[model samples]
Target: MDRISDFILPAVIICIVGYGFIKKAPVFDLFLEGAKEGLCTSVQILPALVALMTAVGMIKASGALDSFTYALRPVAALLHLPQEVLPLALLRPISGSGALVIFQDILRQYGPDSLIGRIASVMQGSTETTFYTIAVYYGATKVQKTRHTLPAALTADLVGFLMSALAVRLLLP
Candidate 1:
């Protein structure tokens, strides 16, 4: 298993180069071109990434997450979900890093094996960073409008968040 893991990348590269040679393709040049395109895409997404990071930082610094968690206490209790996991559930769709901070905090405060910690972990894994994803993908592609994508992604994240909480409560002790 260790040997296979070590050799997997080289093996895949050799296979790809061999296939390219058989097909009379310019493998090295193609690889270089792909690298250039990837760099360009990274450059295009950089500003969006900076903006997102800045926004997340401000929200965190402003204590909005804490306030939001406080406000959601009623709903969380009604749903039989932990109020401590509310930050993770809310921030997971908007920003992964923000959600991770909350998730880690939960784990630190509650211990990984605790029920709230388990629920937070499950919520983090199941949800997607919807806005961050759209920002990066659309920014890289220069898409002018995202037409219904936000709603769909948010809906999926919401469903995933609810299901994750439900499953964790049902499955874990």
Candidate 2:
């Protein structure tokens, strides 16, 4: 099933290309042009990608992420959450890819039965990538700056993490 997903989109694209070629459709030129546009897109996105990575690196290098995890420990205890999830809570808000990586690590460690495993899965499912959102929003628009950008994004991610856990508890046993 998983491999099917890996193959599906490429398979479809190949089919489309083959059909276009057989039918003598104008798709070859269009495809080449599309490929050029995609290269342009990759170039355009490099700045945002670099910026997001740098920000994530700085956050991790500073003690803030550790402090945030430490702060979450008490709440985790009160909620009977597995201690492992404390670091996840901190990661979930700031970096989406990092959180997903950590989520997979928790899943591997606890085999999905552990409280942290289930919660990490839920958090990974529910949360959006904050920097990705900001980048896309800013990239598409002409806005130079926005007020409360960091605070709003962090708040959304925080609320999403809480709700993911709460929803799992209420809905999933």
Candidate 3:
């Protein structure tokens, strides 16, 4: 399996180049053009990405995240979520790396076999960094009026968080 996987990418690349040659396509020029466009897209989104990262850093540094997690404890309890995982849930939508740090802390504090660890692991897989995604993709595309995107993405994140806890509970012995 490992040997086959190692050749998979090379095989695909070889097939693509072969097909391009057979079709008389400028494969190298096309590749360069695609790379240039990707670079332009990265440049276009850089401001939004920087702004989002700065905002996340500020929120974390100001202790606002912890305060918000504390405020959400009652709601979490009502939903039968472990209070320890509240920070991970709250941070998951804003910053993937930040949520990852919180997730790691959860695993370290509770161990991977524990309920909190399981739920956190599930959430890490299920949810997304909504704000970061919106910032990059919308910024790259120059989308001005994101009328329903934010709310819809947030709703999905909430479902992911809740479902992560519920699924773990159901599957546990």
Candidate 4:
């Protein structure tokens, strides 16, 4: 234990000193600059957050989500997937709130202990917020075309969806 403590204490001290000396002034300034940018960024994104939430609310208010889920039933059946997971797949790549709603619906329909519910929960954890990704990328790059973006994004989204299901089945009881 004493040997372990001696080695660990010196290693920690060396790492701290190394980083402090190497980084120096730039690191502190960078951290402060990042914090300031993040603050301004939060304010800038407020409008976007409202718009996204309102749009998602309207979409959910409409009956479109039900039909969308229904349309995917055949595909899910063919894939031997649980019906409970269909809504999550459809919503996951579009909007975070929409995806959460679908995730909650899956939990409600399948129960938390069920395979589909576990898979949906895992899917939520593993994947990023897709709409947020596109928004950030487009916002930063100012690309307006939106051509080929959906398909490319969907490819990754689908993989995340399938991977979550497979992972839950393979890993969880």
Best by TM-score: 3
> How many clashes in candidate 2?
0
Q: Report lDDT per candidate.
A: 0.86, 0.78, 0.91, 0.77
Q: Per-residue alpha-carbon lDDT of model 3 for 1-173, expressed as tens digits?
A: 99999999999999998999899999999999999999888899999999989988898799998899889989999999999998898889988888888889989999998988899999999888999999988988767999999999999999999999999989884
Comparison by TM-score, 1 against 3, better one = 3
TM-score of each: 0.83, 0.74, 0.88, 0.69
Residue-wise C-alpha lDDT for candidate 1, range 104-123, written one tens digit per residue: 89999999889888888888
Question: Candidate 2: lDDT of 21?
Answer: 86
- Candidate 1 lands at a TM-score of 0.83
Q: In terms of TM-score, how similar is model 2 to the real structure? A: 0.74
Regarding TM-score, does 3 or 4 come out ahead?
Answer: 3
Model 3 has an lDDT value of 0.91
Clashing residue pairs for model 3:
none
- How do the residues 14-98 of candidate 4 rate in per-residue lDDT, one tens digit apiece? 8865787786757666667878988877676666666766776788678787898898888877766677777777677667877
lDDT: which is higher, 1 or 4?
A: 1
With a 3 Å backbone cut-off (N, CA, C), the pairs that clash in candidate 1 are none
Q: Model 4, residue 34: what's the lDDT?
A: 78
Ranking by lDDT: 3, 1, 2, 4
Winning candidate number (lDDT): 3
